[model samples]
Target: MVKKKIQVLFEDEHYIAATKPSDLLVHPFKARSQDRRSLLRSLKKQTDLYLFPIHRLDKPVSGVVLFAKSKEATRLMKEQWNSENVSKHYIAMVKGVTETEGVYDFPIKTDKGLQEAKTSFKTLTSNDEYSLVDIEIFTGRQHQIRKHFSRRMHNLVGDTKYGHSSINNIFRKDYKFYRIFLHSYQLRFIHPFTKEEVIISSPVTEDCIHIANDLFQFDLTNIGNEAKEN
Candidate 1:
């Protein structure tokens, strides 16, 4: 298999933002017996810099991931993340038609026990089969979006763990989509050093655009283009 190069969205002395592909681990996991590829190692090899992950995307999810160039930068960025100052936005294609706009104010169980988690979503378009929605997460809980949507019976398309296999098979058979239909579309936070507000966004993947067009007749490409212009 050919290696997919990580797409860098923004980079500077203090930080780097890149698009992570699905199935790529942000850091090494000790539990997995087999040696697995990691995004941190790949980025370090590619840039020859000591990069520190300030935030993470789940292994099966793709899109905007942030890293700090130095430990000090990492410390500063983590402050923003821990304080809930960072704004995370995502675009997802799910199994059922959701409400036009609403918040999933639910708590999720973690190693630390139950924690308050909330996600706000607005349906961009939908058909009888599926809904395309924009999601904004207020708390960074493990698998929060997936769990919230799954609990509502609107699991994200291609989510193997929380989604129905029959629904996943439809997309796999029809559109050949195997990865989870969740992308980290945008990230907004204050630059720790400069005190400047920074917003970084990644365009929807081509596969996602094609699937949305074929399934719901929604043009995600146009939406991505418009976002670039703004």
Candidate 2:
């Protein structure tokens, strides 16, 4: 088991949000895998409380993950998330330079079938090789960000699943980085229990910052600051 200190971003009676490291499962598979590392189990042990996940992040993706303290709070928070009351923001470094800003209404295929997914992106900074983009997602469809960007030829750096192998190889040899460059930087919504607006922002990992600086001379320290507004 890989032991890592769980970085809790926000904690209250009804909710807890934490920063999930890259390559860590949000929860274990039903059948379970050989690797026993999981974010939920670690949080349960660290906080010594039952926690319910309100949203999920991909195993290779890093950033904010929200949980409810109890089953009732989970139900309420899930309702708020299902509605239009929540905003999710992410930052990514893609293979190609992107437009200044754009919205993608591409539908992602799910177990149910093709579902409508919308993503809005603003190119924070870019060079000839890659673009650092700030993303706002309106839907929670499976692999929404990855699929949408990959379809448009702007595959995320280090995304072996959706990116070009040659491109990824070039980056690996050049930058010597492995994790995918997609991060859930911020989540904002109305508190289901207290009715107060809640905003949870996760800072990009040190690796992410280092790679961005090397690639685009970018600074991710305040990447989510402008997107904090509701």
Candidate 3:
């Protein structure tokens, strides 16, 4: 079987960002000859440069993933991510009709104990079964978005770990959806080297687009444009 090339979103001397497909790891657990499915590995082969992973999206989720071209670049970018200088946005399909806009400032359980996490969302559209939401996350805790929404019973569609089984079944059968309905659509930060603001957006994946349109009667082609305008 032939592997599909990962789509590059933004690239420069310091950083390279790409749209990560669902089921691909950002980094490998261990280096080996057969472990060829990771995004980091593929990007390295594609660009012939040693890439440093800047952030992560779970293997089951799809969207923007960034890498720094050098260690110095990595440190500077990580500083922005660790502080309030970064903005991350996502789009998700949840099991229930959500409010027009709201913030989930609940703390998430981590290895260090409960850490502060804030996830704010706006309902883009909805139906009797589910809703499409635009989300902004303030903290980069692991599984923060999934946990926050699931805690409120607004579980993301197709999220087996923290989702509604009945709704997952419905989408699996009716909409042919099989992956978690969460996407990191936009990322904005100050370029640590260039000293200019940079905004990068990844378009919704085809699988998510198909299910979203089928379930919500929405078109996802303008997703990137929407992120840029906002």
Best by lDDT: 3
Query: TM-score per candidate, in order?
Result: 0.93, 0.93, 0.92
lDDT of each: 0.85, 0.86, 0.87
Off by over 4 Å in 3: 30-36, 225-230
The TM-score of candidate 2 is 0.93
* Residue 212 in model 1: lDDT: 83
Residues 98-205 of candidate 2: C-alpha lDDT, one tens digit per residue: 999999996788777999999999999999889999999988887889999999999988888898888778877887777788899899988876777888888888
Candidate 3 at 211: error in angstroms? 2.0
Clashing pairs in 2: none
- RMSD for all candidates, in order, please: 2.1, 2.3, 2.5
For candidate 3, give the lDDT of residue 110: 76
The sequence of per-residue lDDT tens digits that candidate 3 reaches over residues 19-54 is 898888888855663555799999999889899999
